[model samples]
Target: MKSGYNVAVVGATGNAGMVTLRILSEREFPLRDIVAIASTRTLGRVVSCGNRALKTQKISDINWSDIDLAFFCAGEGVSSKNAEIVADRGCIVIDKSSYFRQHPKVPLIIPEINLDTLEKGASYGIVSTPNCVVTPLVMTLKALSEVASLKRVVVSTYQSVSGAGRRAIDELYNQSKEIMTTRSSRPEVFSKQIAFNILPQVGNFYESGISEEEEKITCETRKILMADVKIAVTCVRVPVFIGHSMSVACEFSKALPTKNIRNIFEKIEGVIVIDRRGEESGYVATPIDVQGEDAVFVSRIRKDTSVKNGLLYWIACDNLRKGAALNSVQIAESMIKIDPSLSKFRKTYSRTKEA
Candidate 1:
């Protein structure tokens, strides 16, 4: 641990990568220097990091040995190839990718849920952040699972085009314009036209009809919860641009009081309950409201009447922030908290200032 660490943001020109830089600057992470690394195509571009503009360097050009911490927001392919290399160079890598998530050695972390896993697995040198859809789902479930033992969970996600990447976002906008002007559109980034349409399938489906996205939710929920709860998931691509939303139903061993359930969520650090069920508008959280926010907004909470011990709720969160960048930055912050050696000045400054 040094007084200030040199950090690098991989895939710096991508949406998640850019957000990671912004968060690091917004949070004022203790850093000596910050570097942005991207693919050759993005090299030389400038990415805004709070008040600064960081010029992007090619990933191949990065000197991994010089970086103390690296946030990897590059897609799975790039992460798979470079994560180990970065770690081997003695740099801590917090990766936002699916490639290493399921690995027995790699700890898939949602700081609020399983940060201890990171502290315990520090020797591994690499930590993984979950998929965008898995983030809010697991965060909401952890609270309920603690109050009542979870038996099963069912989730249907309404993911946004941005989850696919910037090109997908552009495709959605372009296709919507074409449809409005000419009554026809083309699909390229997505399997079908994403504009003005909701695709029930998110990722490729297997013989059992479970999509890759669905499988991720199922496995990830179980892992993060550290429970054997059975999970069923259906992931859909929606027309929204930034936030990811999910309708989740959970079955517990015993019925949980609705008031108690609300209390549990309200007490959780990163969750916000917007339940206004009895009001004139009886408003609920939606993607538009949660686009740039870090907190998981949960609403429409109630007991499932059909089941003996079940609860239902709707949740929305910024996929790029809490789902990816913010979570990665939080992991770095948690590392500093858990291992004081990682922060060169935080402990000393606190003690000296108090004195």
Candidate 2:
């Protein structure tokens, strides 16, 4: 393996970008240098990397060939405009936007469920992270699907304002304060007043009456699980700031005991089960409790009496972390683990370019 790799993070000033930078440091990712990149307006701003400050550079000015790997945490517009350029310049791009997610050539990946897909996509130099909602959903479903044949999945998401971005988070804060003092607030970042309220719409509505976020959950789940399971989803914008929570009900091909279900989840590497249905165990996981946590927290497991061979549960995860930044980092780590030769290849390419 090479000594280390040079990395570039696009959209470095934004929520997901900043978290990606922090995760790289926290994980002690092997790196020779790290570049913080953003749009022209944010150029020259400073972003923290461990104890040091890295000045943000505009994406237009980056020399992609000099970077070994790039994380695209910018929005779909930025990603759509730049992802292929970076990849063509020989830098692997792990995009966290929805722009290239559905592309047949770009593998939509959740490392826990589909590292093999990622490995396959490496030849193309681009991989896409799924919608944050899809991450925990697929993680939980994959575990259950292994033990029981999943026939259908129904999910309702209580997503946080942060999922919308920094502006939405600011809107939530300002609106809550305004409602407390003036009894009125404007709804700009969201379609409705988010403070002391909930909005059933998380994204623009489609002709099918489903929101974009809901459609993403369904489509991306199917892609990740590679299953023809029937899926239904409703996404809501909740006032919480950092985590996304989901109420999931699944119908299996056969009845699986609650104990077996819980056992299955407990054995998974990135899943934590907090089921304490009938006792005062204080074991339920809420969005507030899961902020900054890495695990997909599952709780409230029970049988769904509405359908035979069905089960119900709740899940909470840090949308910005495991849902976005951390997942991208994990994908890169998976690349390294699956092919140690990648590090050697990156080093060889770097030296050849220098020469």
Candidate 3:
């Protein structure tokens, strides 16, 4: 409906926000204007988009009427308070926080797997992106589900420090340096030392014994599939810097041949299957290699002889990108594909205001 949409990136200085800005530029998203927004504390901080440097602003300072779209990566509290309010003013919001993933009215989307959900309209003028683990998990499963009924999924994640945010990254670096120098650095961002060590816990545990990250991956996966498949997960925080990795085992009701799995993943928009055997079996996808990469690289595909119709595989991805920033961008891209004006949501809010 217009030459280009006006866009904004909330939390522009943080990891996810920075990546979101870079992606918007890299993908050449049509934008008549773009603004960087962070907290009042970051008012003078400048961030980049392509060749442009943008000084950050507070959400309150932006003209909501002129903003056509926004990417919210500030965290749950920030998104819970601002994303919907921004949306209500007619700007389509693509949120990366856990706040809206399961909201009945907000679609938890993985663009490649469920872009069609955009056709239904973004109620509340908002869309939600899944967790880093859920993004790849759902993509692989959804593809497999097309050939078989997904009955159970078991996942063990070796997530990196960056998934916890920039602070955790600093913690890992400082601690590793301290250890190398035969000095000591007390853990700050993480509960324990993250250098040359692993923490089996990714998020806090619930009363039911499931960690928050585990529950999120499974819950979000089920929500996206619109199915009640059984899933068991263990989310571990590893010492890696940028990528998140997972070892997944899935059980399907119908038999799935290993030969078909590679083809299934190849067809996925942002997935790359690298399960080559012989000389390449030892070089499957790893966190260090996938850092900064956008695609979900899956490897080590095989059959789980222990379970009926079961498949086992490994996945690696840049959590800061596909897990957060790129997902928001893709949702916006899908929105544009459905309606350049993003009228599916803009009109919904406008009509609600008129009433």
Compared with the true structure, all predictions reach lDDT values of 0.85, 0.87, 0.86
Candidate 2 lDDT by residue in tens digits, 276-295: 76786657999989999999
lDDT of 1: 0.85
Query: Model 3 over residues 200-314: C-alpha lDDT tens digits?
Result: 8887889998899998988899999999999999999999999999999999998986667778888988898876676733668888888888999999888899988889999
Clashing pairs in 3: none
- For TM-score, candidate 2 versus 3, the one ahead is 3
Error of 1 at 247 (Å): 0.6
List the candidate 1 regions with Cα displacement exceeding 4 Å: 343-355
* lDDT, candidate 2, at 307: 98
TM-score ranking, best first: 3, 2, 1
How far is each candidate from the true structure, as Cα RMSD in Å?
6.2, 4.0, 2.2
What would the TM-scores of all predictions be?
0.94, 0.94, 0.95
Most TM-score-accurate candidate: 3
lDDT of 3 at 249: 94
